[model samples]
Target: MKTITKTSLVAAAGMAAALVAGGAVAQTAGIATVQPDAAILSAKAFDAANQQIATTYKTQLDQAASQQTALNTQLRTLLDTNKDGQVSQAELQAAQAPNSAIGNQIRAAQQKAEPQIESLQRPATLAQAYAIEQISQKYDAALRAVVNAKKISIVLTPNAIQYAPPATDVTRDVIAEIDRSTPTVTITPPANWQPQQDTVQLLQQYRQIVAANAQRQAQAAPGAGAAAAPATTGKAPQGR
Candidate 1:
């Protein structure tokens, strides 16, 4: 029951290989900079969670990597076959047969490993999900406790508010709480514990802002209209 499904094994291995092969980094203006990613990834809780996952899941991961490596070796051998001090046309043609053969080996390996890895990885991913949820919940609880204990009217995640007094950020306590309640042995996110806010509030806010802007624009229209007429002196306003 705990075996890695072949799909999981192959996918996990492929992703790891891709990462190791000089992975492409997306170019986002500020986000691509080393400092932001380093700061986020270096956080103790994040490192702890990922390391814990790796520790619990490393066996299958290693096996997957090993399988992938073997496939790569097989492929390379096929491509480089008959390469003995001279590159010949016959040798080149002969290599195609081996290429086909190597492809078969890799495919077979993927088929076998995919099921095993998936079965194994499902449990780990479930654990990850649970842990993230627990951490977030604990963080919320701690924020509430701190807010109530300190008699503060509000406390928020740092980026949530456009501007708050320095005291409003309860990040330290949140992190402490999150770390303390880290999921012991799970990777799956809780089905009910969605961390992202829903669309209702966002839509409501957008509508309110739009209405206010429309009102302001309407109020200014009379003044603007009286002064500008789109250079009508040259062409009688094109449609009038």
Candidate 2:
């Protein structure tokens, strides 16, 4: 929910058209670029895994989403001092004043909602981790194979350079390798299974990408007004 809201699978790795065209960068002799998260999430296996997860954890996901919506409404009501039905930066900051009564109320509300939401979300989170773990296990070998095949000596993230031709982007190739090597991943974890911190973090990023996509879709919907409010964060609408 943190940085996840701003992440998008297509935008983060490469745009969809570019990916479908096998990525846009032209390859340099000894260098290639990859965006690991993008490649992993874009794989066909990940899509299949997500559908399974949605079904497997439908109850928990529905409950958590409902709770979050209610919480967002409550937070907006508490912070929208002008009664304009919108919580803006100025409104949130006013509510966040040191020892302010509304601040105390808002904090109390969030404190209560946070645990319940997290609890309901746990199942899906774990399921995501389980799927990611399965796919990620094959990532290193897949990457190395691509690197060797291309005779690339150095691999870098998309952000590592100022510019590169689209052909240099190997994200699509890596995704292909992952899909072939790990055609499907299990969403079911052992009863005692717990994800490592890295998996947890990666899943978090994946979720964020999902959220960002949802927001974009919502904004682009037919009836979406120019002034349509952004999705609520269950906290101040802006930094205090």
Candidate 3:
């Protein structure tokens, strides 16, 4: 069977989290600093925006999975002539011969479906990155106001600081300002939009590395029935 695993797609999605968070951190000189996570979590509109993105992509993933499952079933049915419940290496080799009718059909189906399956990975990552950028840009004014009110000269993300008193944290104040000004954000993005070029390139590299590793592991796995030698007869059979 020709298997197109989605390990790379999942790796790309995991990289998106870093990209989103990277945009939220900004360096400034200040007596007080606020954690972006605390502020973002507290904002109801930000939460809603994330939920909307997740729902949309989850539906897309479900549809893609269903389509791929149907295609795999068709390919298996054509190749498993003996109906032994497993497609052995020998059986697969026979089906893939140049003149094999079933083999040609399987190859054709895979050619049509592979691109459709691979296309889902990038957009899924882009949607979340776009949503994060939009929310951060829309709330910048609120965040600035909190900084100014506290007479803070610098604003740093939580990770940048080694230790600080609770009194120096302005996360709650920023959240309150965001809630007051923008109660809810729009979920839909403009047409034909894409994420920043740098982020896209980084994600692509990460996917490639993960995919290479998965391929190596698959190649090293033992073939079916390699674990035990054929049972030996007690003695050679008598001549007929």
Q: Tell me each candidate's RMSD, in Å, in order.
A: 23.7, 5.9, 15.7
Q: Could you say which candidate leads in lDDT?
A: 2
Q: All models: lDDT? A: 0.38, 0.67, 0.54
Candidate with better lDDT, 1 vs 2: 2
Show where candidate 1 strays beyond 4 Å. Answer: 1-52, 68-120, 157-159, 163-167, 180-240
lDDT comparison, 1 vs 3, better candidate:
3
Q: Candidate 3: list runs displaced more than 4 Å.
A: 1-30, 37-42, 54-58, 65-115, 121-124, 197-240
User: Per-residue alpha-carbon lDDT of model 3 for 1-240, expressed as tens digits?
Assistant: 122223333333333223222232233346666655445434666455545655666656555556666776777766776776556666677776889887877778777875665455335445544544455654578878887776678776667989755556666677678778877767565786655554344333433444456446655776632121111111111111
Q: All candidates' TM-scores?
A: 0.37, 0.77, 0.45
The sequence of per-residue lDDT tens digits that candidate 1 reaches over residues 1-240 is 122223332223212111111223322221111121112222245444555666777775566446544543444444444534333445444543565664455456546655544554544444444443444444446545545544565433334546434333344433344445542324445564433332222222222333344345645875432211011010000110
lDDT of candidate 2 over 85-115, digit per residue (tens): 5567776676768998888888788788877
Give the C-alpha lDDT of model 2: 0.67
